[model samples]
Target: MIEIRRSDERGHANHGWLDSYHSFSFADYYDPEHMHFGPLRVINEDRIAGGQGFGTHGHRDMEIVTYVLDGALAHRDSMGNGSTIRHGDVQRMSAGTGVMHSEFNASEHEPVHLLQIWVLPQRAGDQPGYEEKRFDDADKRGRLRIVASPDGRDGSVTIHSDASIYAALIDGAEQAALPLQAGRRAYVHVARGALTVNGEALAAGDAAMIVDAAAVTLEQGRDAEVLVFDLGALNG
Candidate 1:
């Protein structure tokens, strides 16, 4: 079964400096019926104007990830981690017990487009951590490149959760596929461009909750960037 969430149906907020779209319940965008799917908690598409950003924020027991789509994002935290995440970069922070962090546009002219994601950790108060990595363009072109995983396999960032995140770039004639087990589920997010998931067409900002499928296919599409989550069950 596949449940589709049209882009326009999501909660949207347009701050002068920060334009955001919430895929699940976030801040004032609460929707009890769309709180979350599997272990994925939040998917916020954010665009921060130059010289602006999020001030120090606190979080606990969540596996947070930031994927920079365009421009650059500067980050700093109480954990003594400070850096700039640019396009093709993936950043992960494990707020096991608690952590404080801030994000800002790294450029003085260009705005930063990014996705801030949250996934429930497997256990509370395990340990605090941070990691960042860059994936080759070839790795994501025409295929899903695993960028985050529970075991940190293949040089990907480690997340304290029983799930994996992959990114793909599909253009004309390029495609990819993922196979799933009986109890697993998937979340597909379209960052930009147009594509088809299995047989359903989706455009930028659209998403799908998939289950009970033996395998899924993503057809290469014009200017399309996609994120896929192979998620495990959450006890809640």
Candidate 2:
């Protein structure tokens, strides 16, 4: 079965310099029915105005991943990791034990757009860590590239979670597919443009939760960039 979450149905918040849309319950946007899926916790599409950003904050036992779609995001953390993440960059930060970090738009005149994702870790009290990689358009064009995984296989960033994240860039008639394992589920998130996932149309900010799906397909895209997550069953 496939369940669709329309872009307009998400929770929204605007704070002068920051505009954000939450795919699940976040901050002040609480939805009991849309809390989370499996081990997937948060998906926040954020746009930060020039010279603005999130102040230093703390997190624990969360596998945090950030994907920049436009502009750049400057990041600094308590673990002494500092970097500028731009388009095509995937960053993973393990907030095990505990950690404090801050993120800011690296431009003074241009706003930065990005998706911040959080997944529950497979184990608690692990050491804090960070990793980042650039997945060029050529690597994702007409295909899904594994960008994050439990063991960092295929050069993906390690997340210490029973999940793998795939990134894709599709245009026109381009297509791609990922075979799902038994008992696993899938989550497709459209970052920009439009895409048809297994015959269901998804626009920017839209998402689909797929259960008992043997395979997930992407086709008939219109300049689309999407992220697909293969996740293990939720723990009770």
Candidate 3:
């Protein structure tokens, strides 16, 4: 079964300095029906004003992944990790017991657009950890490139969750496919441009929640950039 979630159907919030769209129930945007998809708990598309961003905050028992689409994001965490991530960079932080972090736009004049994802950890109470990696456009062009996974396969950032995340950049005549094992599920999110997923048309910000499927096919892309999540049990 595959269900399409339109871009406008997501919950939206704007705080002058930040504009965000939540794919799942988050903060004040509660939706009982859209709480989560498998172990994927949150997908927030955010645009932060230049020089403004989230202050020091705490999280626990969650695997947080940050993907910057445009501009740069400066990050600092309790683990003493501090750096700036631009487009093509993926950052993962496992807030096992607890961790404090802050993220701000690296530029003083350019806003930063990004996606912040939260995956429920497979097991709680592990020690906190952090990892970052860069996947060039050439690496993702016309294919689904693994960016985050439980085992950190292919140099992807590691996450303490039973899920694998893939990124892709496709244009006309380019296509990709990811075969799924029995009982596995998939969530496809279009980060930019338009594309067709398993015969379903999707625009930027759109997503496809798939289950009991044999594979996820992406094609007929119009300068599309997408992320696919291969998930485990639904009760994460």
Candidate 4:
């Protein structure tokens, strides 16, 4: 089964300092039927106001991944890690035991736009860690590039989960496909611009939840940047 979730259907919240859209139930946005997909818990598309950002917050037992789209995000964590992540940068933080972290727009005049992703780890209470990597736009222009995986394979960031996340940037005549093994599932998220996923049109912030499928295909894109998650079944 393949299901499409439109951008307009997502839950939205707007504060003076931040505007966000939640793909699943998060904080005050609760939807019983849209709680989660397998171990994928949260996908929050956020735009932070200039000079304002998330204050130090605590998290535990979750694998968090941050993907920036516009501007730069300054990150500081309890693990003594500090950096500025810009476009095409992927940052992964394992809040295994517990961790406190904060993110702000590095620029004083421009807002930062990004996606905050959460995936459940295979087991709980492991050691906390951090990893970040940059993928050139050329690498993902016409094909899927492995950005995060279970073992950090192919230079991807390591996440303690039975899942693999791939990213792609596509334009006219550029296409890509990811084969899926039986019983596995896939989720395609269009981060920005418009694209065609498995022959279906998708706009920015749209997503496709696919199950019992052989593969996920991308084609006929118009300046599109997308992320595809190859997920293991729940509790597998």
The CA lDDT of each predicted structure is: 0.93, 0.96, 0.97, 0.95
lDDT of 4 by residue, 163-205 (tens): 8999999999999999999989999999998999988999999
Q: Sorted by lDDT, highest first, which candidate order results?
A: 3, 2, 4, 1
lDDT of 3 at 43: 100
lDDT of 1: 0.93
Q: Which runs in model 2 stand beyond 4 Å of their true positions?
A: none
- Look at candidate 4 and tell me the lDDT of residue 67: 95
Candidate 1 lDDT over 3-29, as tens digits, reads 889999999999999999999999989
Best-performing candidate as measured by lDDT: 3
Q: What is the lDDT of residue 146 in candidate 4?
A: 98
Please state the error at residue 108 of candidate 2 in Å: 1.1
lDDT of 1 at 227: 95
As for model 4, its CA RMSD to the true structure in angstroms is 0.9
Q: Candidate 2 on 36-131: residue-level lDDT in tens?
A: 898999999999999999999999999999999999999999999999999989999999999999999999999999999999998999999999
Model 1 root mean square deviation, Cα atoms: 1.0
